[model samples]
Target: MVIGAPASGQGKTTVATGLMAALSRAPYGLDVAAFKVGPDYIDPGYHALATGRPGRNLDPWMQGEERIVPLLLHGALHTTAQQPNPARIAIIEGVMGLFDGKAETEGFASTAHVVELTESPVILTVDISHASRTIAATVGGVAAFEEGVKVEGIILNKAGSPRHADEVKRALRRLGIPVLGVLPRDEAIHVPSRHLGLVPAAERDESRQALDALAQRIADNVDLARVVKIAMTAPRLSARPWDPAAEVHPPVAETTTRPRIAIAGGRAFTFRYAETTELMEAAGCEPVEFDPLRDPALPPDTAGIYLGGGFPEVHAEELSANASMIASIREAIDAGTPTVGECAGLLYLCREVDGHPMVGAVDATAAMGPTLVLGYRDADGTRGHEFHRTTTTPAEPTMAPNVHASYLHVHWAGAPELAQEFCDATHAYASSRPDLKHHGDTEVGEGLVDLAVNVRLPGPPAWMTEAIMATLPGLGAYPDATAARAAIAAFHGVTPEMVLPTSGGAEAFTLIARAIPGDRPVVVHPQFTEPEAALLAAGRTPHRHVLAPPFTLDVDALPPTDLLMIGNPTNPTSVLHDGEALRDLAGPGRIVVIDEAFMDAVPGEHESQIHAEMDHLLVVRSLTKTWGLAGLRAGYVVGDPRLIARLAAQQPPWSVSSPALAAMVACTTDRARVEAQLAVVRTTRDRDHLIESLTTLGWDVVTPAAGPFVLADSHDPGTRARLRVRGFAVRRGDTFPGLGPHWIRIAVREPSVTDALVEAARV
Candidate 1:
C-alpha cells in the first residue's frame, strides 16, 4: 500500500500504479489485482490499467475496512482464474496523509486506518524537489507518528539533482529509513487534474502510456527486485469467511437446477458486486449474465432480471446505437421480467437517457441534466448514496414499486420488504393490476406459473432498525407541546399561538410558500430547490440570481420583488451570505424568507435573520440534518401569526405524524443536546484544514465554503475518475450552473470521511 499527503498533486497514485504495472509485467507471470483506499473512482482506473484487473476501493466510513479483505480475496480468486498462479500482492493506494482524518484522532480515517485494517506494509511517497535532507525528518516524523503504520520504504519524487538525492539519502540514513528510489521532476508524465481531482483513467487515452512510463521510470530508479522481495516477505493474511457463496449456499436438492434470476453482465452491466450475483445463486436461483449492449435477448428462461450499476451513461451513444438489444430487453421486461435496476442500469431501463434513445422499458426518459444527482439518503436503511449526474423524465415512478428503476444507489441493508415489495409490485403488474401503475408505464410480465414466486426481503433488518429507532427516544425526551410553545414564545417574543410545527425543512418551506400571499416572488439562486419548487407550483415565476463569481452573494443581483427566498449557507456550495447585507435588502415592501438549514453550524445566532420581526422575516429551522434526524423530518417555521395560521390551513389534518411532531418539539427544546452536537463540528474544521492544504498544491478552492463542504477545480477529467476508484465520490462540478465544468463539491460528514477526501485529492 502507498500513502501520501492530502491533495491531488501528491505522488501516491503514481507510485501505486507504477508498482502494480511493473509487478504485473514480471517474468514470473504474477497476476495482480488492485484496491484503492476510500470511495474514489479515478485511481482505480490507473490501477486497472496497470494490472489488467478491476480496481475496487475500500471505504471505512461507508462499508468499513473489514469489507476490504473479502473484496480482496474475491479479486484474488478471480485473478487466479485468469492466471494459474495469482500474485499475492494486492496494490492498495491509500487516501490523504498517513494520519490526517476526522481530527487529531490518530489513525481515525487516514491511510494509517486502512493500513492497520489490512495489515499491509506502507511505501511513503514524498515530494522532495524543494527539500533534500529535510525529507528524512519528514519520513521520521510519519514513521514515528503511529507504530501500527509500518513505513517500509520511501519514494522521493521530483528530486532536483544527484546532489539533492544524496542529501535526502543522508537525511534518511540518520533516521535509519530506506530510500526506495529517487524520481526526477517530469511534467511530461504528470497526471492531469480537475475540480474533482484526477480524471478517470478510462476517460483518458494517455492513461495507459502514463502508467507504462511511470512503471519504467520507477523500475530504472527504484530497486524493483528489493521491493518485490519485501512484498513476498509480507505475511499472508488469514482467509476471511465473508464470501457470499460460503455464507449463502444453495441446497443440494437444488444442485442441478438453473437459477431464477438473470443479471446483465459485460461492460455495460459490469458495475455490480460479484457478491450480489453470488447471493442470488446461493438463494436457489440461477444468476445468469447477459450483455445489455450486445445481447439480442434476455436469457430465455430468466425468471427475473437484475441490471446493476455501470457506465451506461458514459457509453450512452453506443447503447443507443444498439437498438436491437434495447428493444429486446424492453420486450422481455414488458413481458414480465422482474427487473431490478440501479444507477447506470436505471438509465438503460428508461425511454431516453441524456438525449440518447434507450430501452423504452420504464416510461421515463433519462436526460443528462445540468444538475448532478447525489446525496447520502436514508432510502432503504442501508444509508447508501447517489454519485451520478442525470435527471429522469416526468414519467418516472413517484413512489415505491417492484421494478424500481431509479438513480437511487440503494444498499441492501436487510430491507427485505423493499425487495419483497418490489417483487409483489412486479407480481401485481403481471396480474394487470391498475393499482400497481402508481406512476409511469408499469411493465407487465408473464404471471408466475406453477410456482409461488416468493421473495425473501428481510424486514427492516434488526440491527439497522435499532439504529433507526434510537433517534426516536432521544428526540422523544425533548420538551412537551406546552414547553415547545414556551420556547416558540421565547424565540419570536410572541404568544405560542404564532408558532406551528411541521415535518422538516421541506414542510416549513412548503408551508411558507403556500401561506405567503404573493404572485411575483424571486428566489435567490444556488439555494435549496424545495422553496422555489413550492413557489412555482403555486404559480409563481420566482426569478433567480445565482451566486456570481467566487460564490459571494451580491444584493444588487436580486430581482425587484416584495417576496424573496434564500437558503442561508446555501446547499451545494455552502456559501454563507452576510446577515447585515441581507437585512438591507428587506425594506418595507419586501418579505425576506431564510431557510437556515445550517444556521446552527454557524456560531453566534446573530448571523440569522430571526432577530428581525417574524412577520417580515420568515425563518425556517430543522433538527433533521443537524441532529441526524433526517428520517424523522422534523422542523418548524417561525413567521407572522396570521401567516402561520394560513400555512397551517393548507396542510391536511395532522400532516406531521404524532411521532414526527413529538420528535420536532423535543429536539427544539433541548438546547443542551444541540450544543453537545456542536462539539462534533470541531472535527469538521480540521477537515476544512485539509482542503486548505490542497490549495497550496494548486487546487482552485471555491470561497464561502465554511459550512461542512467546499468546491474546487481540478481542470482535468481523468483525475476526477481516478479519484472515484479511490473510494471517494466527489460531486461532479458541472451540475451546478454558477460553478464551471472543473468544479467539484465535497460534503463534510465525519472527520474520517473528510480525511479520505483529503487523501483522494492528494493522489
Candidate 2:
C-alpha cells in the first residue's frame, strides 16, 4: 500500500515509517516491507529502521515500466530481517507530492504511477495544521484526478482538535473514504535532516528510541488492522518473477575465485539498489562491502569496485584523511580492475573535493555546485538518475580502461543487461508431492454432455493458455517460485510465508498430512476425500466426522482433534459452511484445514476462510476447477506461516511445473478475478435453473448449494446408467463417503445446456 500525501510536509514519511514500526512491533505483529516511490534515498533510511527490512525504491523511471510490479512483489516476498519472514504488507512512502514526478514527464515516476502499476491502494496523508475541511476537497480531487489510483482512505496529520478532525471526516463522508487516522501536533515526532535530506537513521544514536515513540504515537491514533485490511483490498498484481539469472548474461569464468565486487556502504555511502548487488551475485560475483571513512583497505581479492551514491561531500575531510584507503582504490583502478562509480563515488574519484586530496584517477577537481543536477537520464538505451550537487571540471564521467565513473544512478532491475555486462567483467565471484482424490476431471465422451465433475472451465482462458505456452520455452530452467508466490500472496491477501504453492491442492494435503503434527487428525466426510486419503497414505488413522443429511457442519458432534479438515461448499454435498464456524474449530493446538477449491464457484465467496487470519487454520485453493487447468495442477495453501513452512519443506523441489506456476501467475490478477467473478454470477444463474428443473423432475436437488456442482437425489439406483444412456455423464455419488448411488453430482453449465440435460433426463 502507498502511504502518500497531498504535498510535502504532510507527514507521509512519519506516518508510513511509524505504521511500519508499529505493525511490525506490537499488537499487530505484522512483518512489513517498506518502500519509497521515487529515486531519492533519504526517507527509505528511516523506513528501513522502522521495518527492520531494507527499505527499497519503486522508481518507474529508473527501473522501467515493466519492473514496477515485479520489484514491489520481490521486496514484499523477501525480507532482510534478523529472523527473515515474508512481509505481510508493504508500505510505500510517497516522494514529494502524491502526483509529483519528473517536472517534464507529467508524474511519470510519481507515487501514483507506482500505485497504478502495482495496483496498490493509497491512504492519503494531508497536513491539517493549516487547513480543515478543505483537506477533504484536496484528497477528493487527488482521487478524482487519476484513473486506477485507488485512494482507500486518508490520514489527517497535525489536526488541531477533535472538532477539526470531525469536520474533515464529515466532509470526507461524502467522498466515501474513511479518515483512517488523525495524528495531532507532536513536536517529538520529527527527524533531523541535512542538505540531501533526512540524516541516515544509522547515523543517529537515538534513532531507535525516537522511532519507538513515533510508532507509539501512530499506533495510538491509527487503526492498524483497518489499514491492513485496506492493504489486503489492493488487487493482485500480475507479472512473471524477474529472475536475476535470466536477466544477467551467461558468465564466462577463467579463475577459480568468484570476483569480489567491493560495494561502498557506510555512513558516507548508503544509496544503492538492492537489486544491483542481487544481479551481480546472480552473475557469480561476490559482493563485498567497504567503508571509505574507516576501512584501511578493500576486501581481499577485490576484482571490481562499485562506489554508489551517498554523502561523501560531508565526509570529504575524513575521506581525505584515509590516505591508505584512497591509495588502495587508486592502485586497483590503475591495475585495470573494473570499477564503476555513481554520484558521490564520482566526486570521490576526482583529484580533490573542497581542496582535499582524493583518488586522483580522473584528473579533475570536484566541489559542491551552485545548483543540483538531477532527473531521469536516458543515454544509449540506458536509464539512470543524476542526483547530486557536486560538479567536476571534466563535467562528464571518465570511461577509461576498466573504469566507468559517473553521477548517473541506475537500478539494475531496469537495465539488467548492464548488471549482466558488469558482472561478467567481475566473473569469478562464486556463487549465487502427492495426492488423493475421487477425481474431478471429467471428459465428455464423443458428444455426451459433461455434468459429472465440478471443473468450472472446459478450457483454460486465452491468457492462461498463452501463459502455459510461454512457460514451454523455459521448461529447462528449474522453476523459481519468487514471482508465483508473491502473486499468489497478493491474490489471497496473505504473506508469502503463509502460502505454499503446490502442484495442486492434492499435493498440499499430502504435504500437510506428512508435516503437520496431529495424532488426533479428523477428516469431515462427504466433502472432498483427498485430505483423508493423504492422511491414510502418511500412515495416520483419521476419525471420519460425517455430517448427517442436509449437511450443515455440527462441530459439537465431533470429538476433540488436533487436526480437522473440511471443505467450503463441500463436494458431493454442495453445502457451504460458515467461515466463523470453521475458524471456531481452530485453536492453540488444533488445526482447521478447509479445502476451498470450489469457493470460486460461489458469488463473492462470503463464507470462504481463505482470508481469515488464524495461526492454526489453513485454506487449500486450486486453479484446476476455476480455470480448467487440472492437468497443469496449479494450487496453493494459505495458512499459518509455520504450518506453511513445514508443508513447503516437505514438498519436492519443482513438483509444481513451470507451466503450473505460470498458470498461478496468470490466474490471480485483477483481470482474471473480474472474469472469474462474471463466471461465478453466470454459474449461479444456471445452477438455480438446474435446481429448479431437477426439483420439477422430483430429483430433490439440495437447497443452498454454493459450489459449481449441485448434488441431487435422483431416487433411482440406475440414474447414473440412465444419464449415460441419455448422452450425459453425471458423477456417481456412491464413491463419496456418505452418499449412496441414488445421489448424483451435476456440474452447472449454461442455462440452455442445463435445460437440454433436464430434457434428456425427462426422456
Candidate 3:
C-alpha cells in the first residue's frame, strides 16, 4: 500500500502511521512491515514507532524496483515466518503527491511513480479545506496525467465539518474513486514540520502520544472494516519475494575465516539501509555493533569498521565527552585499520565536531551550520533527505589512506574494493587460530577481516578507456577492431559496443562542436572545463559571455550565436541559471547546446534545462562526478532531429554499450527515481542550513541553489590546501578562470558535513 499527498503536509504520514498502529493491535496477529518509498528518515521512524517493527525505506532510485519487492517480501516473510503469525502485510508510504516527479510533468517524485513500479494502488491524502468542486479537476488531472497509475482511493484530510466531508465524499464517489476516510480538522493531531519537512518521530519526544492519538482517531473515524476488506480484496499477490535472492547482485565469496567487522550502530549510524549491512554479512564478516556515544571503546575483537549515517550533531556533547571511545576509535583507525564513514559517521571521524572537541579520528574539524546540503545521489539512485548537524573543516583532504570519509552518502558504486583491501589488511594483524588461520599476514587486529567476503571487481569498467582513447588513441594500434576485442577480453564481462568512450566531457563537446556549425558558436563558460576546450579543439572560435556577478544570467546578455553553448547553473560559478531564459535564447538558424552535467545535483527535473521544447536545442548530460562514474566516461547528448543526426554521424558506430549503456538506461528510464533523489537534496539543504550559515559568515551566497554545489566568495584569502590542514578539500575559484581566488565551490553534502565547513570558516 502506497499512501501520499498532492504535496507534503496533507497527512499521508499521519494516516499511514495511524493505520499501521491500529493493525498491529488487531486480533488477526498480522505480521506487518512498513517502508517508505524514497530517502526519508522521518516517516520511517513514525512507521517504526507505530508498527513495533523496523520500517525500511524501499527506494527504487537507491536500489532498484527489483529490490523493492524482494526487500518488502524479505522484511515481511523473514519476520512473519519466524513469528507465530500466519498472516502478514506490507505498507509503503510515499514522498510527494501522486504523479509529481522530476520528469517533464508531475509525478516525478510523486507517489504515482512508485505505484507504477510496485503495482500498488494509491491512497491519496488530499488536503480538502477551501477547495471543493475543483477537487474533481485535481483528481482527474492526476488520474489522466499518466495512464496505468491506479489512484484506487482517496482520503480527505482536514475536512471542514461533517457536511463538508459528505459533500467531498459524494463528489469523489461520482468520479468512481473510493473515499477511504475523511479526517476532521483536529489541531490536536498536527505533526510539526522543521527545516527538513516533518520532524522525524525518533527525534520527537511526543511521537508516541502523536502516534497513539493518531491511531485512535483514525480507528474511530475511518472505516477500518472497509479498509481491511479492500486490502484483502485487492488482487492477492504470489508469496514470491519482490527481489528473489537469485535475482539480486550475488553475495560475495566468503573467506574461510570470519572477520569481525565493527559497525557503528545505535542511533548515530541508524541511517543505513539494511541491504548494505546484509551485504557486508554475506561477504563473510560478522558485523559487531558499537555506539560512538555509549560504548567506552572499540570491541576488543573488532577488525574492520563500517560507520553508516545518523545524527552526530544532535548528540555532539555526549559523543565529545566519550573520551575513552574516541581515543580507542582513533587508535584503531590510525593503526592501519580500514574504516568507511557516511554522513554523520563522516562527521564523527573528524578532528572535532562542531565547537565541541571530538575524537580527532580524521584530520578535520567540524562545525554547525544552518543550511541543508541535500540531493538525490547519482550513485545508488536513492532519493531521501540527509540532515546531520556538522561539517568538516580544511576540507581538501577529507579522504585518508585506510580511512575513507565523505558527506556523500550512497549505497552501491561505493568502493567495495577499498573495503575489501581494508578488510584484508586488518585481518593480517589478528591472532591466528588453528581453525581460522588462512592467508598470509595474520596478526592481532588483522584477524577480524579474515571472515570478510570480498565482492569487489578487480578494476573499474573497460569503457573507462573512452577518456584515455580520446586523449591518446595513437599509443595503441588502429584501436577500433583490436580495441573492441581487447576491451571484451579485458572486461571478461561485457561486449565492446556497450562501451562508448569519450575524452572526458571534451569528446561529448567535440560531437557537439561538429554537429553545430556556424560563424558564431557560443561557449558557456564557468560551467564545465570542456565546452570551450572542445570548440577550441574543433577550430571554432567560440563566442563567450560570462553570467552576471550574482551568478544569475542576464537574458539580455545572451546573444544569438547561431550556436549557443550554455551550462545549466553555469559550472564554476554553480549558478542555477534560469532554463526558461535559455529557451528564450533559442530560435531559427540557431542551435543551443545545454550542458546539464551539474544539473543532476539539483533534486527536481523541472529545474533542469532539458524541459525546453525547441527543435534546435541540444542538451549534454554526464554521469561522471554526479554518480562518481567519472572514470566510466558515460555521457550522452539529447537533441532534436538535425542536431542528433549530426552528432550521431560524428561518433563511431556502437559507441556506448554493455555497462555504460546499462547504467545509463538504468538511470534515465526511471523519472520517479531522480525526483526521489531531490528529497535528499532538499534534506541536505535544510539540515546543513548551508546558505543561511554561509551568508551569516559574510560569504556572498547564490540564492535558490538548484545545483548540487554552491559558489561563494570567502571573507578570508586562505588557499584551499590551507583549509585542507583544517580538514576540507574545497574546489577553489582559480580552477574556474574568470572567478577570483576568493571564490570556492562547495558540494552540497550532509548537514553534518557542511556544518564542519561552516565552523572552519567562522569569522
Candidate 4:
C-alpha cells in the first residue's frame, strides 16, 4: 500500500516507517515489507531499520514499470524466507508529494501512479498543524484529481490538540475518507537530517529508540486496525514475484560452469542490489560474498572481486585496522584477478580513504572532503563502465587488465552485457548440466513451406511497415518510449505508467525469468517452452504441470506455488481456459501470469486478461503474431506497475530498437487494431478449414483449436520427414515437455497451402 502526502515536509517517512514498525509489533505481528518510491537510496535505509527487512527502491523511470510489483514481491517474500514468519503487509512510502513525479506536470513516477499500478489504496498524510477544515479540501482534491488513485484514508500530522484532531476528523468524515491517525507536534519523533536526506539509520545511535517512540505515538493516536484493513484491502497481485535469479542473464556458454567472484559485504558495503549477485550467477559465475570488515581473506578459489557502495567513510578506521583483509584484496587485485569497484568500493581500493589506509588496489588516495559528486551519469568513453549514479571522489586508473574502480554505482540490470564482459575478461569458467534451448525455428531449415513457425507468413501489413520505416531516420536518437507507452495505455485504458513495451514476447519471458522472484515456480506444460527455457536459463528449474489430452487447466488440482504460468488459448493444444477460473488461481501471495501471445488470434479476444487490474495478475501480449511482425520482435506486458518496473529493471538500455517501438505504437492505434481484428477472423476461418481437412484425411487432430495453429497426432516418427520430403515443414512436438514425436503442430494457411499439406499427407 502507498503512504503519500499532499506535499513534501508533510511527514510521509515518519508515518510510513512508523506504520511499518507498528504493524510489525505484537498485536499485528505482520511481517511488513517496506519500499521507497523513486531513486533516493536514503529513505529505504530508514525503512529497513524500521521494518527489520531490507528496504528497496521503486523507480519507474530508472527501473521501468514492469518491475515494481515483482520487486515488491521479491522483497516481501525474501523477508519471509529470512525470518521465522512471512511478511503479511507491504508499505510503500512516496517521494516528494502524492502527485509529483519526474516532472511537475506529469505523474509518471508519482505516488499516485504507483498506487494506481499496484491497485493499492492510499493513506494521505497531511500536515494539519495549522489547518483543520482545509485538510478535507486538500485530500478531496488529490483523490478526485486522479481517475484510478483511491484515497481510502488520511493521517493528520502535527495536530495542535485533541480538539484540532477532532475538527480534522469531523471535516474528513464529510468526504467519507477515514482518518486513521493524528500526530501531535513532538520534537522526539523527528528523525535528524543531514547533507543527503536524513543521516542513514545505521549512522545514528538513537534510531531504534526514535523509531520505537514514533511507532508508539502512531499506535496511541491512530486506528491500527483500520490501517491494517486498508492495506489488506489491496487486491491480490497477479504478476510473478521478482526473483534475483530471474534478473541475472548469463551467456549460454557460461551456464554450464561458474567462476567464483568474491563480493564485499557487511555494514561497510550495505548499498547493493540483490540482482548484482544474481547477475554474476547468470553469467556463469558464482558470487561468493565476503566481508572486508571481518573476513581475513576472500573466499577460496576466488577468480574475481566486486566492491559495491557503502559507508567506508564512516568505518574507515575499522577497515584500515583490518590490515590482513586489505592486504589480501590488494594482492588479489595486483595478481590480475578481474576486479570492479563502485563508490565506497572504489574508496576501499584506494591508497587511503579519509586518511585511513585501505587495500591500495588503485594508485590514488581517496580522502573524504566537503565536495560531493552525485547524479545519474552516462560514462562516455569510460571503457567497460555503463550507466550509474555515484557519490564519491574520483580516483586514478589501475594498471591491471579488467580492473575497474570508480565512484559510479552501475546497475548491471540496465547493462547485462557489462557483467558478461567482466566475466569474459576474467575468463572465469564454471560448468552446469547441459540443457536444450530448442524451439520450432531450429526444425525449419531452408527450402521448406515453413509451417513449423507460428508467425503469419508475408509479415505485417504495408501500412504498419511504412509506420516502422518512418522511425528509421530517427535511429540516431535513443528510442523514446513516451509515445509508444501513451498509445498502449490508451489502447488498454490504463495510465501511461501501466504499459511496458519489450523487445518481444520472448524477451518478456526472459525479463520475467530474471526479475520475478519466487520459490516453487510452476509452468503449465504443452503450452510454450520459452517460459521454462527462460527460467532454466536464469538458473531456475520450474515444476511442469503437464496436462492430459485436451490440455485443460484444473486450477484446483494444481499444487501450491507462488509463481504460476499459463497460456491463454494455449499453444499446440489451442485450449483457452476460462478467464474467471484463471483469476481464481490468484490469492494474497500468488502471481498468475497469463501468456496471451495467442490471445489476439481468438475471436473477440475472449477471456483475455489485459484489461483487468489485479495486484497479482500479469498479462503478456505479443504483437509479433497478430501483426505478423515476428522478425521485428515486438510485444508488451501488462500488470501491476510495480511488477512491470521489476521486469523492466532487468532489461538493458534501448533493448527495443527504434523501429520496434514505432511498430508497437502503430499496432495499438485504432485503425491498426481494427485491421488486426479482421486478420484474426480470417486466421480462425483458415484454421477451421485446415483442421477439418486433416481430420477428414484420418489424422488425429486436436479439436477446438483456438490459436492460429492446430496439433495433430501423427504417431509415426517419419511423419515430419515425409511432410518435409513433400516440400512442407511442421514443428516436432516431442521437444515440448509433454508431447512426443507422434504429435506435430501445423500453422493455419489458405486453401492452397492446406491442399498442399493434404497432398503431402497422402505421400
Candidate 5:
C-alpha cells in the first residue's frame, strides 16, 4: 500500500514508518516491507529501523515506470539475512505531495503515478493542525483529481483538539472518504531533521525508543485493522512481477568467464536501483562494490565501472583527498574500460566539482547552482531518468570510445538491451545458447506426405495465390497494414485498434512472450509446443499443466498464475473445450491466451473465443491452416486495445512481408470467409472418415476431433518411422510435453490417403 499526503510536511513519513512498525509488532504479527517513492536515502534508513528489512526505492522517473511492480515484488519476496521473514505487506511513503511530480503540471514521478502503476490503494495523511472543515475540500480534490488514484482512507495528523478531529471526521464522512486515524499535536514525538532530511536512524541513540513510541501512538489512536484490510484489498497487479533473471539476456557463451563490473557504493553512491546489479549478473557480468570515499583503488581485476548518482558534492573534499582512488578511476577509463556515469557520478568524473578537483576523466567542470535541473528525461539508452530534488548541475555527457557519462540517472528496467549493449563492448562477453532452438518445421522433409505438419495439405487456392501475387508488383513501397488491419477487425467484429497483424501464429507467440509480464505463466500442455518454447526463449520457464488420459481442461485443478496459455480444439489431442470453461480460468488479475490457430477448422466454431469481449481474454487466430498459407505466414491477435499496443511494441519494423499482408487482407474478405466455411465442412467430414478408418484398423483414436488432425494411442514407439518407411510421414508426439513416443499425430486426409495410411499401418 502507498502512504501519501496533500503535500510535504504533512506527516507522511511519520504515518508510513509508524504503520510499518505497528504492522510488524505483536497484535498485528505481520511481516512488513518498506519502500520510498523517490530518491531520499534518509527516509529509507528510518523505514529499515521501522521494519527489520532493508528499505528499497521505487522511482518511475529514475527507474522506468515498468520497473515499479517487479521491484516491489522482488523486495517483498526476498529479505536480507538479518530479516529472514518474507514480507506479507509493503508500505510505500510518498515524496512531496500525492500528485506533485517532476513538474507541477505532470504527475510523472509523483505518488499518484506509482499508485497507478502498482494499483496499490492510498491512505492520504492530512496535517489537520491548520484547518478542520476545509480538510474535506483538500482530501476530496486529491481523491477526484486523478482518474485512477484510489484513496482508501485518511489520517488526520496534528489535530489541535478533540473538537477539531470531530469536525474533520464529519466533513470527511460527507465526502465519503473514511478517517482511519488522528494524531494529537505533540512536539515531543517529532523526530529531529537536518539539511538532507531526517537524520539516519543509525546515527541516533534514541531512534529505537522513538520508533516504539510512534508505533504505540499509532496503534492506540488508529484503526489498524481497517488499514490492513485496505492493504489486502489492493487489486492484483496485471503486469507480471519483474524477475531479474528473466529480464537479463542469457549468457552468449556458457564457458566464457563472467566480467567483473566495479560499481560505486557507500553513502556517496546510494542512488543505484536494485535491478542494476541483478541485470549485470544476468548479462553474465559480476558486480563488485567499491567505495570512492574510502576504497583506495578499483577492485583487483575490474573490466567495467558503473558510477551512479549520490551526494558527491557533500564529500567533494574527501573524494579529492583520496588521490589514489581518483587516479585508479582515470586509469581504468583511459585504458578502454567500459564506464557508465550518471549525475553525481558525472560530477565526480569532471575536472572540478564545486571548485574541488575530481577524477578529471571528462573534459568539463561541475558546480553547485541555485537552479535545479530535474525531470523525467527520455534518453537514448534508458526509458526515463530521474534527476531527483537536488541542487547540483553537471555538464553534458562526454562520450568517448569506452566511456558514457551523463547527468541523467537512467533506470535499466525497461531497457535490458542497453545492459546487453554495454556488456558486449566489454572484454568478457559471450553468445546466447543455441541448443534450445527447435520447431515443427524441422520435422518436414522434401517429397514427404507431410502429415508431420498440421498445415493444410494443399497450398492456398488459385484465387488466393493470385491475390497475393497481385501485391508483389507493388512491393516497391513499404507495406502499409492500415487496410489489412481494418479488414481483420471487420472479420473479428472488433475495432481496428484491437487488431495486430503478425507474421504467423509462431510470431504471435514470440510477441506475447516478449511483451506480457507475468512471473507464473502457466501453459496447458499436450498442445502446440511453441507457446512454452517462446516463454523459455524469453528467459522464462513456464509452469506446465500436463493433462493425462482424456486431456481435459479443469479450471479448479489449474494452479494460480497471472498469465495462462491454452489451446482451443487442442493441438494433438483434438478435444474442443467449452469456451465458458476457458473464460472461467480468467479472473480480475489474470491474462488468458487462447491459441485458436486451427479454430477455423471446427464445424461451427462453437467453442472459439474470438468474439468474447472479456478484457483479460486474448484470442490468437491464424489464416495459415484454413487458407493453406503457411509459407505466407499470416495471423492476427484479438484482445483489449491496450494489450494489443503492448504486443505490437515488441515487434520489429515491417515484421510482416507485403505478400503476407495481402494474404491476411484477402483471407478476411467476405468472399474468403464464405469459402473458408465450405472448406471447414469438407475438413470435418474428412476428419470423421479418417478417425473411423484408424479405429477400424484396431487403433485407439481420440474421438470428436474438432481440429483437422487426429491423435492415436500407439504402443509401438516406431509408429512414425514405420509410417515414414511405408511412404507416409506422421508427427511424433514425444516432443509434446504430456505425450510419449507411443502416441502419434496425423493430419486429416481424403479416403484415398486414409486407405494408404491404413495399409501402411498394416505393415
Candidate 6:
C-alpha cells in the first residue's frame, strides 16, 4: 500500500518509515519492505535504517513504465542478489503530494499512477492542523479527484487537540472515509533538512535513535494491524525477481585475484544502485567503495572507476579540499584508466565545480545552471536520465582519453552491457550474445523432406494465385482492407466494428503491444515467440509462464496482469485449451487474448472462442498456415469494438496490401472453407501416423495433437543432426521456452514422407 498526502509537509516520510519499522518489529514481527515513489534518495536511506533491509525506489518515469511492479516485486521478494530474507509486505512512501508527477504532464509519475499500475490501496495523510470540517473537504476532493484513485483511509497528522481531532473525525464520517489515526504535533520526529530534502540517515546525528522514537510513537498512535490489512488488499503477484547473476552471462574466468573496481560513495556521492555492485561481482570484478568527500585516494590497484550521481555541488568545497583523491583520479585518467562518470560525477571530472577546484581530467568548468535540466532521456542509443541543476562549459558529453563524463544517470541493471563492456576494458572477459530469432527455413537443406516449415502447400492454391495477379492492375491505387474486415466479421459472426484486419497474425500481436495500455502484460510460453518478441520491441518486458511437460494452459498459475496472451491449438505444443477456462480468465480488470492462429486447421474448429461476446476477450486468426498464404500475410483480430478501434488506430493507413486483402476475403468464402477442412483431414491422418511411428520407437510424443506440427522427444540429443544427414529437417525444440534440445517439432506431411523420416529414425 502507498502512504500519500494531500500535499507535502503532511508527515508522509515520518509515518511511512515508522509504519515499516513497527510492522517489522516486536508483536507483529512481520517482514516489511520499504519503497519510495519517485527519484528521491534521502527517505529510502531512513527507510533502510528502519527496516534492516535495502531500500528501493519505484518511479515509472525513471525506469520504464512496465518495470514499476516488476521492480517492486524484485525488491520485496529478492532483497539482494544473494536472495536473503524476503519481505512479507511492502509499504511505499509517496513523493511530494498524491498527484505531483513530472512537471506539466498532469501527474504522470505521481503516486496515483503507481497505484493505478499496482492497484494498491492508498493511505492518505492529511495535515489537519489549521482546519476542522474544511479538512474533510480537502480529503473528499482527493478521493473524488480521479475515478481510479481510491482513498481507502486517512491518517490525520499534527492534530492540535482532542477537540480538534474529534471535529475532523466527525466531518470525515460524513464522507465515509475511516480516520485511522491522529498524531499530535511533535518536533522531535522531524529530521534535519538540507537543500535536497531530508539529510540522509547516514549523515544525521542520532538518526537511529530518532527513527526508533518515531516508530514507537507511530505504533502508539496509529492502527498498525489495520495498516497490514490495507497492504494485504493489494493483489498477489507471481513475478520472478530480477536477478543480476542471471542477467549477465560472462565466460568462466580463472578464480584468481578479482579485478578491483573503484565505486564512488559517502556523503557527496550517496546515489548508487545496489545491483551495480552485484553485476560487477557477477562479471568477475571486485567493487571497492571509496568516498570522494573523505577518502584520500582511490582503492589500491583500481582497474575501473565508476562515479555515480549525487550532490557534488553541495559538498564542492569538501571534495575540492580532498586534494589527494582528486590528484589520484586525475593521474589515473591521464594514464588512460577506464572511467565513467554520471551527473554529479560528471561535474566532479571538470576543473572546477561552482568555482571550487576539482580534477582537471576533462577540459571544462562546472557551475550551477539557472534551471534544473531534468526528465527521462533516450535521445541516444542508451536510455538514461538527466536530473540535476549543474551545467558544464562546452556542454555535450565530454570524452578525454579513457574517461567518459556525462550528466546522464544510467542504471547498469537495465543495460548490463555497459557493465560488461567496462569490465572488458580490463582485458579479461568474454562476450557471447545469444540470438532469439528462430529460422526453420535456414535449417532445411537444399534437398530435404520439407518438414521444417509448417506450410502444407509450397505456394498458394491456383485461385489465390489468380487473385494476387488480378490485383496487380489495381495496385496503382492505395490498398483498401474494408472488404477483408467485413469478410472476417461476417465469418466470425461479429460486428464489422469489432474486426481488425492486420497484415498477418504476427502483426496483430504488434498492434496489441503498441495500442493496449498495460504495465503488467504477460505472455504464456512454450508457444510461439512472436507475442513475447512483440512486447519486447514495444518497450515492454513480458513475463514468460512456462508450462510443464505435456504443456497445458493453467490460468491460476498465471501472474496478475491486465493483458494476457496465450495460444489455442498452440503453435509447437499443439495443445488446445478449454474454451470456457480461457473465457473465465477475462473479467473486469483483465483482457484475455486467445491466439487461435492454427485453429482453422482443426476439424470443426473445436475449443475456439472466436465468437465469444465478452468485451474483455479477443480472438486472433490467420490464413498463413492452412491456406498456404504466409507470403501474402493475411490475418485479423476479433474482439469488442473499442479494442479493435484502438488496434486499428495503431496500424498505419493502408497497412494491408491489396493482394493480401483479397486472399483474406477469399479465405472466408464457402469454397475456401471446404478446401481447409479437407486439408485438415489429410493433415490429421499424417499427424496420427507420425505419432504412432514415434510412439512405437519409445518416443515421448504429445497426445491429442490438433495442429499440423507434432512435438516429440526422441530421447536422442543428436536426433536433429542425424535426421539432417538422412535428408530430413525438423524444427529444433530448444528455441521454445520450456522444451530442451532432445525435443523437436516435426511438421505433419504425406505418409510417404513420414515413412522415410521413421526409417531414418529407426537407424
Q: How badly does each model clash, as a count of residue pairs? A: 54, 5, 88, 44, 7, 0
> Model 4 over residues 124-221: C-alpha lDDT tens digits?
99999888888889888988998898888988899889998998888888788888878899999888874445666766778899989988998998
Query: Could you give the candidate ranking by lDDT, starting with the highest?
Result: 2, 6, 5, 4, 1, 3
Give the alpha carbon lDDT tens digit for every residue of 1-763 in model 5.
Answer: 8999999999998999999999899888788989999766668878887888878888887667767888888888875577787888999999899998877548887999999888999999999898888989999999999889999999999999999899989988977778899999977669887444565675568889999999999999999999999999987766566776787664555544676788998767766666677788877788999999987677755778999877787788999988768877885676567888887787788888878899888878777665555556767645455453334444544456777877776667667777777776654411221112335566677766777677774688888899899997899988888889998988878888888999998899999999987766788988888887798677555666879877877788997788999999898899888898888776678999999988888876888777637577788988888877888889989887778898999988889889999898888877888998888888888888898888887778887788989999877888888887778888877777778777888888877888888888987
User: What's the TM-score of each model vs. the native?
Assistant: 0.48, 0.55, 0.52, 0.50, 0.51, 0.53
User: For all the candidates, what are their Cα RMSDs to the real structure?
Assistant: 29.9, 28.6, 30.9, 27.2, 26.3, 25.8
Error of 1 at 129 (Å): 5.9
Off by over 4 Å in 2: 79-83, 253-256, 395-399, 428-763
